[model samples]
Target: MQPDPSSLLQQALRELDYGQQPANLYDPIRYIMSLGGKRLRPLLTLLGGQLFTDELGPLVKPALATEVFHNFTLLHDDLMDQAPLRRGQPTVHEKWNANVAILSGDVMLVRAYELLFENVSLPLLPQVLRRFSQTAAEVCEGQQWDMNFETETTVTIPQYLDMIRLKTAVLLGFALELGATLAGASATDAEHLRQFGTDIGLAFQLRDDLLDVYGDAATFGKRVGGDIISDKKTFLLLTALAQATAAQQATLAQYLGQPILDAEAKVQAVRAIYDELHIRPQTEALINEYFQAALQHLERVAAPAARKQPLHHLALQLMDREN
Candidate 1:
């Protein structure tokens, strides 16, 4: 049976020992890992392995690599975004300097690869490393695309979707596929798991976009309209631009361009236009479409029906049961 995800996360955390040679360099690694999130990606890795094999021991190190790599990206991402807070605490760059954060993040990347190699066989190691390398590069490409969208107001729905796919979905895909590969799952089944993770990631990101505009402030952990205030080209804004009329488009441009307005006013104005264009419903429909597509991939995983149920349940929960 699969270990409880929460316990698995705790156990993985306990096993991490980044060493003490350079306290400054390694402390940040420990600090960031300590400030944990849902640990979903690592859990996916463990789950994927368990679905194919009874023993989960070999999967732990490789699975933890995904989370380590994930945190490494976040360290750099926080620096790039100049994000003041993460998990309601000061970010790596905030607590330490940018140079320290960069160096620490770099080491984390190296460590992530080291961890993945722990239990993987010499022959199969190349396959896992190659795939991990590709996914890591794609994440950087996605970050670039996201930055591009900031100035280029003409970004289309497809373009935004692709950006999210690279930035968020691909890692999630790798998380699931890596476990299956480690467990010696067939190539076809592994591919299905990867596709399943990717599709679920797409829908999960859209849900995040929706929540940014509609989620309660207390629950969201930040201001609900921070994206609108900053003119971040989220799905809601992009969709509104796509479906709005010439007149509606002009009004939107006016609101988006007005940077000096109070935050509430800007959010309210943009959200008013969103409601007018029925952006919420349009986004919800698209999320459901992607969620359903994810299920199709999950169904193709070739695992026993019972083994697949846990992942299936998670996919549904992620998309808000729209599927």
Candidate 2:
């Protein structure tokens, strides 16, 4: 019997050797990888493959490639955002330095490609590379758009949705598609799985936006309202802005315009706006929309229901939709 996805990935990560030379360059890579997360992307890859075939051994390296690339993005993202922490620990740039973070993140990208090229069958290599490259470029585009939104005052909900889809959802789609492709699933089936992943990814991110304001700081693994304090445009904030009365708009603007205010006061003020506007339910409704769409796509995949159960359960669990 194949090992569970979590255990399988843990063993693979433990055995990965980044080569010890100039500890500074390689150390950050190891450090970030060791900072545990849900390991969701790679696990999706494994589950994607399981939908088509039982021999999951060959999918391990490619699945790891998704995880490696993901962390590489986070490493650089932290640097760009000037974030102090990741997974509740000092970020790479914080622990080391910006230069180290940049270089190490670059190397991580190279290593992700290496992992992909190492095990992918030659016949499948071109297709895999093309998909991976497109996804990588889109992720960058999304990040750039996110940064642009910080300065641009005209951002819209549709634009925001597209941004998150590219920035966060596409990688998830590609991960699942990669696994299905590697496992010899038909292109049609693979695309269905990809759509399922993309939809789930959208809901996952929207849930994150909701959690930032309402979640327990300890469970959320970061300070609640960090987004509010920064005036980072999230779905909640945007929705509230759209729905607020002129008086409410003035109130929101009053709090948000302050160059400096007590962090708690800012959070409370913004959260009060969100609460009055029913932004929580609005966000939750949108999340459910995407989640239900994901399930529809998952149902369309040609695989047996039993084979698809793990992925379905994972999707439910990730979105807190599980009964």
Candidate 3:
């Protein structure tokens, strides 16, 4: 069976609080951890660890490391994105200050290592640290690429996919692989687990693109049409650009770079064109293709079905979530 979100989330919150002090740093850490996210990274780590064995006790520390790394990214990302809010609350930078946010984020990164490096076997520590470092740098590279995309008018669909894969998906891949490694799974099995995560991450991002325009307002947390408002270069938009007629293309071009345009009207107009082009279904089909590919990679692993079943179910639930 899939894990319940409420109880699982609570457990993760409690885990986040263990062995922490210094109210300045710990307070912000506690606030952010308690704010609530999908906890997908940690959950994947736990599941990945389970592929080698059913016991979860020894896995919690490393699994928690995955979450710490995830939050470290979010902390810096909010600063970079100039995002005012996270989980419907003030972001660290917004609630405090940029310098404080940056320092706190650095501490979180250190804490991630503290948890990760503590119990890691000395022989394996070097490889684990290397993987973590590579993953962190790649995530930063992905973010830089994402920021670059904001100014570029002509990002190809393939390029966009690669960007998201590095920015969002690789971390998920790392979470799974790291857990598998900690559990002493064969390298081949760990590699397969990583591939599974990468594919699912791609699909998850594509589904997020679809949901930004089409999801129910209540479940979506933030505004449903923020992507359209921001004129983000999502798969749907890129595909629409590729498919639009000359007049439609011209219409879209006029609104994209202009500062004086009405946000809502542009959203509606672009959405109307997207509807006319059947973009929503096209995007959904693409998402499903990646999801199926993810499952295919998972199947390549030699582990028993029972060992992987929970993760399989979790993936399905994430794909089907209204939020």
Candidate 4:
């Protein structure tokens, strides 16, 4: 019998820890992975693999490779963003030396591939490896673009969308496609699954941007308005830029570009302008647009409805989540 999904996740977590050398490195990996956020990407991949076959034995380890890889990115990202905490704990770089953090991250990538190719059929393993490499490179390109946007004074909506497509969405799409391929889905079906993941991932990122500025602080898991405080070029900020009036433009310029401002006051100020321009509703509408597109692709996949229902519900939950 196929292992239960929850059981598979647990088993994968266990397998990830096998064969660690340095206790220091191994302990931190355990610590970060144990911090516990929604393990959505790996779960999606496992679900994707199971859509074609009941056998999860071959899929669980590779599916978890995605999660490990993702956390690796988070470790490095926290360093780059100068983020003090992750999931409410000190970031790896903060708790350990930067060189150690970098070295550990490299090990995580190596382990991701080890898990992926360990039991994979040799004939098909190269193909999986090549595809994974391409996806990994694309994710890096996306991150670079995201960083580039910080120095950029002006960015269009389309450019922002494309940037996010690479940075945030491609990995999600690749996760599904990876699972589908492992399960022997037809290439076309795998592509459809990938498209579904990409669409939903885009929507998910947009929703996060929305929640960062507007969500309730209590339920948001982190402080609301972080993006606004950092002056990050979120979709909402772009939309506000597109719609602001002369006075609104001056206000935005004065506050968004200024330093040494109060967090709560800045949040309240920006929100007042967002309200004036109705940017919140407009952003919500755009988020709905991507969700609809994702649903359309999901409905076209050649999988059984029963098998896809859980993933569909998961997509909905992610799109609607506050945190």
Candidate 5:
């Protein structure tokens, strides 16, 4: 029987080891790792492998590797964004100084590689590492593109979609792909799982975009309408731009990027434009499209109905979230 993800991950985390050579470097690693997250990537990795192997005991190392690398990316991203909080607490850069956070984050990446090196089998190590390396670089590239879009006023919907694909979706894809590969699943089945994860990741990000503006403030964890205040060129904003009348476009240009404006007023005004353009419904349509595409791919995976049920259930839970 498949154990619940939370119990399995908790057990895995307790056993997961890190070096203690430099207290300063390792302290931050411990601090960040202790800050709880969903552990989705690692869970997916294990589940992906389980589609082939009933035991799933041997896949623990690579599953944790995905989680470690995921946290490493989040640590650096928090610094780069100057984010104040992560999981409702001070971010690494905020808690420590930027220099400490930078050094600590670098060590965390090295440690992630170390974990990979020590755990994976000799025969499969090279292929696993190669895929992981590519995913890491693409995540960085996606983050760079997101930063670029912050200042560039004319990002197309297609371009923004591609950015999210690289930034967010690929790792989810790699997580499932790695698990399947380790379990000796055929290349074809692995590819199907990868594509399914990618599509679901896309839908997940778009939901996040929607929530940034419309979510209940307490449930959302950040200020509501954050994307509007920052003018972050999300799917809603990009589509609004496409559908807006010339005068409405002028209104958007007037309110957005004005430093002197009140934050609440600016959010309300931009959201007003969004409502006029029917951006919310349009974005929902697109999100549902991706969600359906994900389900389609999940259907194509060559696993038995019972074996695939857990993944199918997890995908539904993710898609139905309001926060």
Candidate 6:
């Protein structure tokens, strides 16, 4: 039997060399990469390329670039958010120091570019780099908007959607587009693949928000309601805020405004509000909307249906994940 795309990506990651001299700098990169999650972005890259061709060798290094870039973002994001854990291990900032995490994350970003430059064909390099650069900047912009939303009293759903699109979805888009483009997919098919990724990315993030509150603690891989405790402006919180009545609003404010409280109590109180507003169903509804949209775009891609099966199945699996 053939090794799966995920197995190929994982083996490549294991064999990756990030230099040995600067143990501190390189070790953290290795550590964070080893402490793994789904590796969804890079896998999408491989799948996108596979849609166009059976040869996945050329896609591996470039696909690895997506994972490197993603981990780089997580390293810095953990620092910025003061998150203690990632994938249930001590975050880079916690295991090392904030400075180490920051510098290591910077190196990972540069390394991601290096991987792309080394692997991608010269003919496609400029176009790939352009899209990657724009995606990187948009990710930063999205992060900025997310931080700003925390302080700003009024954040509309559209604004929140756009923020996630930039911060989370665009990178996913670029991963698929990169793979498709590198595999010689036509421009139209590549765009459709990008859109497919973007839509799936949106749904993925929203599902995360849903699971934070609703997922079982054992399988969820992290503490349920961590988002609520932190008061991160997720879709669930934002939607509940929008739909809440004057009384419900006051309750939400009282809980959210508290500087110090029992963590579980806060989660319970906030979760009650979410329950009252039927936020779970609403969030699921929107996730379904984006998911269905993703399928529509996938259908638009000009690949043979047989060739598209792996990606289609992967998308379904992503939507079904509990963690």
Q: What TM-score would every model get versus the actual structure?
A: 0.96, 0.96, 0.92, 0.95, 0.96, 0.95
**Residues 1-323, model 6: lDDT tens digits:** 54489989999999998767579899999999999888989999999998888889889999999899999999998999898989879999899999999999999999999999999999999999999999999999998899898888888999999999999999999999999999999999999999999999999989988899998888777679988998888999999999999999998888885794688888998899999999999999999999999999999999999989999998888888653
| Alpha-carbon shift of residue 235 in model 2 (angstroms) | 0.7
Question: Model 6: how far is 34 from its true place, Å?
Answer: 1.4
For model 2, residues 155-201, the per-residue Cα lDDT tens digits are: 89999999999999999999999999999999999999899999999
Scored by Cα lDDT, where does model 2 land? 0.91
Model 2, which residues run further than 4 Å from truth? 321-323
On the 0 to 100 scale, the lDDT of residue 118 in model 6 is: 99
lDDT of 3 by residue, 1-323 (tens): 64443355357558564335556666677667777777888788878887787655566677777788889889899999999999889999888888878878888888888878885778779998898889889888889989999999789999999999999999899889988888888899898889889989999999998888888878877787788888789999999999999999998888787784577788788898899999999998998898998898789887898888888988898798564
| Model 5 misplacement above 4 A | none
How far in Å is the alpha carbon of 229 misplaced in model 3? Answer: 0.9
Question: What digit string (tens of lDDT, one per residue) describes model 4 on residues 254-321?
Answer: 88878935888888888899999898888889888888988887788888899888788888788766
Model 6: how large is the Cα RMSD against the reference? 1.5
The deviation in Å at residue 269 for candidate 4 is: 1.7
**Which run of 10 residues does model 5 get worst, by summed lDDT?**
1-10
Relative to the true structure, candidate 4 has a C-alpha RMSD (angstroms) of 1.6
lDDT string for model 5 (229-290, tens) is: 88789999888888889999898888777783688888888888888888888888988998
Q: State, as a TM-score between 0 and 1, how close model 5 is to the true structure.
A: 0.96
Backbone clash pairs for candidate 3 read: none
